[model samples]
Target: MPVPVPRQRDIPATDSGPAPQASLTLLVVEDDPAGGLTVPEILDADGHRIRIRSARNLTEATRLLTPDVHCVLLDLDLPGPGPGEDGLGALREVLRIAPRHAVLVLTGEADADRAAEAVRVGAQDFLYRDELDGRLLSRAIRYAVERKRADIAQYKLAESKLRAQENARLERGLLPTPLLEGSDLRFAARYRPGRSRALLGGDFYDTVRTPDGTVHAMIGDVCGHGPDEAALGVELRIAWRALTLAGLCGDDLLATLQEVLEVERPCEEIFATLCTVDISPDGRRAGLCLAGHPAPLISRPGGPARLLPYDDSGPALGLLPRARWPRRQVDLGGSWSLMLYTDGLIEGRIGEGRERLGQDGMVEMINRHLERGLSGEALLEASVTEARRLNGGELTDDVAVVLLSRAAGRTPAA
Candidate 1:
């Protein structure tokens, strides 16, 4: 195991205090035909002695690298007899061997550009030989280590912010307005990412309606968990909305999506499963299509929840060039609810056994919640919470749920 180096806290560089103890050790690499650095002895500003383990070239440097050594001062000019171990090349080799070691280059004053390039390529800092001083050199080493750590932290922060912004844009495009101009049906959704620090995953949803009040809603999951998969999901969701608004539905829409995946996926095996529902204008019937996705669950007021019958739906997108997802129409009583969800909701392992809470188990769990009189947000919350509890941990796969309630003559708010 590699020893962890403690990050040194930054202290103001000035002349009036006792030098901090050199808990850290450093290695200095320079060419010395006369056997040692011709420069004078070095000491910290506070008069604390800085112990340096010196090496004449790459070969000597290799033997001096130890866990305690925290920094390296490499001379940019040195003759090479070893196969690929030139001066800068040797510096790079030292870095590969000791990645956590803060490396400083000792370059000629005229080679300032190369020094800067060294920093860009991962050296902590560069010290020009002609202008070298004991005090400034120590300060530069301290500052260089601190700055490299701070740079890493800032890069992580910026990456997180970029993810949040991307998720916000995706949310706006995927789950837009209900798109039901005059219909009283309510459409609500929630998405949670399984990636540790990401805001979204390969799960997406959207809703759009045509002129005749046929509201179509879709929820899908692209296989795998990553930014690329999430990006692909966003693209597919956008294409779904655009195609739906353009009057594409059923087989045609799915076929177009498969084509999109073939072109957009980073590689093969990145499949996508989807569940879509088209609610009639009167809100009494729904056209359901499943493409290697779980069937939507239905729950009428005062009745147990059950799954909508799913016929031989097609395979997931990106699996086959030509797959057919036939649509099934289901009757919806007034004041009934239907939920479309990704497979992440059911694939979580239950208890310590090999048993996974499959679609049937998920439906049964939802049905029990309904008996306690939970619906809407309450229903979803109770169901998901228990599902997690049964799994004994957070679901590792992305989860997305879209609930559509049709209570025509009497709105659900009643």
Candidate 2:
């Protein structure tokens, strides 16, 4: 609560307002009274007295720290535990007990380098023994406290920016790409971030083609959201791709992924839901795997859109080490469409009172789009946008949708 001194040339022309009442208590730490800590008179910038409390050692400094102490002035000449623990040790312990207290160090005239080191380790700044005067010292104490607070704020802002950048990179890495070279089928997908943009928490999807002409695609969700969980989702997606390229599919692929979750997850009680589709070469049948995940919706010409059968599906990944993922094959007509999506798209409440637009609601919504003649990218965009609108502003959960369509009448190859 010490008074703030104006900068070098900013002295007020209208008589600086009444000095702030002197409530700040400073603790002076020095080993020997005869050696140093012998400032003749310490006073505020406007001549108000500064209550001084002196400590002869670290032990005494610990006792001198109290609620009223705003700052600690330490002696750098004190004995050390090592390069990291000389004056820094005492400064850290002081803060451990009083985290908000500002710290300043007193150093020998030639110990400028060590003084800088102390500041780097968390001290506000340092003052040479012989250069301390009442006004200059008071100003230093006031400015040091403000600088420390600003430093913490800047550090948080920088940490946030770095996390955002990392999330962006991770997002690009986890989502899948279409590998259908020289095919008429157009691939369209979209992802919307939830309330927290830490990463793709609520939704995830991936696609990769195997040595055979088959294309594998998946979209899933990890229950309960945050950056850590989102990161886990990304890890699972990458593992799935690597395993697919390595020839692991169906049950074997998911079992190994569950092992990864058991080892890498930050804690227990976390689980993930997944939906996967493997399209046949002739595009007439799709093998679907539902691991405690929502089933995909199928849209076909002259047929009502409906949820793909998901009976006897396995539990979500990470819940059990040996859980089985039952793969079911469904035959598609000549021309067909399959949409795999995370639950975030449906959990959105349409009009309050705990009413969620469940699986049936989603199927009906898609049929509405069908009536409007919307398809491909336009259809996916409209569906996601409407979901958000129903939820009233962002859905508050990550949403990802992947659609794979098999065009009609391929002329019955050969």
Candidate 3:
């Protein structure tokens, strides 16, 4: 008897009975003008009748293939299509058309060599036409379907791992390596991107000692948290470093950076908050400039920690056409530590409330860490850790912090 076929046409709704449970579908591609090839009544693993659809040629098979069809049975002797003179041509065509579906090849006992070749070419399995029966075909179809699913899953996992490795290499290249070769100041920085599995974000910073024995340090945050913003931040950082090395400082350096921002930013509405500090050769005096950024905190040996002057800060970059940022000079005592940070450090929510750990809370947290004798990397690590603890989880924004310290009786290395 010929295999039972399911209805391919849509049936009008009737209140007489509920819709039938969905069953597994199989497509059979073969050329049997004499109607000799026959498929017995096959039942799936769940005991439901497996619906069959017959296609006489490649064209018919292509038209019959649908998303709901889980498996395909191709006859190796059914000629036409593909390069091989052997009857495996039809098998190859079926495989190409149903890449995501399980496939089985049917062949006579004499053509065992071609059947094995078919498996190597991507068919799930092969069956002898003489041994074809309901029980055997059911088990083979089930195994082929599961094998195809496992193959696809393995491919996706490998692709994900390769992508992660590439991203890690790229991010490491983009991060800054401080150029403090001839400087006596001890530098420490901590960075954490808000995005999951990301090493870098829109926040960027850099420290470089110029030929004039001055150390130029900067920290800035782009307006958004996306790859475009991250790219813009990197461009701004590279430009800042190049300008500083070229003897640009104070308002001139920032003005040129603004120009780069205007040109590189993905949109006109985007802006960046930045803080720049240029330390004199002797390390006892410095010039500070803020462009709508948070003021840096200074801690001295004999006094409390406090924020630098931000009253003279100007508008953020890309905000105005002719904006001017005034550089304020501040005196550094014999021994002190300066901390520069982005807003992400202080903007995390406290507990489950809407209140944030603003600058005031950050100052209090830092003072406590200072009392505990945490300095350099340890200090920065503790501060960030405590902020995360207070917020009850990871901060939803990128955080970048830089610390520059000058010790008494310490001088630049020759």
Q: Which candidate ranks first by lDDT, i.e. highest?
A: 3
Q: What TM-score would each prediction reach against the true structure?
A: 0.74, 0.75, 0.81
Worst 10 residues of 3 by lDDT: 1-10
For model 3, the superposed segments whose C-alpha errors exceed 4 Å read 1-70, 75-100, 105-143
Candidate 1, residues 266-312, lDDT tens digits: the string is 99989999988888877888888889998899988777888888776
Candidate 3 residues 30-98, lDDT tens each?
A: 877655344544666665566678888788889999988999988887885855454577777788888
Better of 1 and 2 by TM-score: 2
Candidates sorted by lDDT, best first: 3, 1, 2
lDDT score of model 3? 0.86
Best by TM-score: 3
Model 2 C-alpha RMSD vs. true structure (Å) is: 5.9
Q: Of the pair 2 and 3, which is ahead by lDDT? A: 3
Residue 255 of model 1 has an lDDT of 94
TM match of model 1 to true structure: 0.74
Clashes of each: 0, 0, 0
Candidate 2 residue 383 Cα shift, in angstroms, is 2.4
Candidate 3 positional error at 403, Å: 1.2
Q: How does model 3 score by TM-score?
A: 0.81
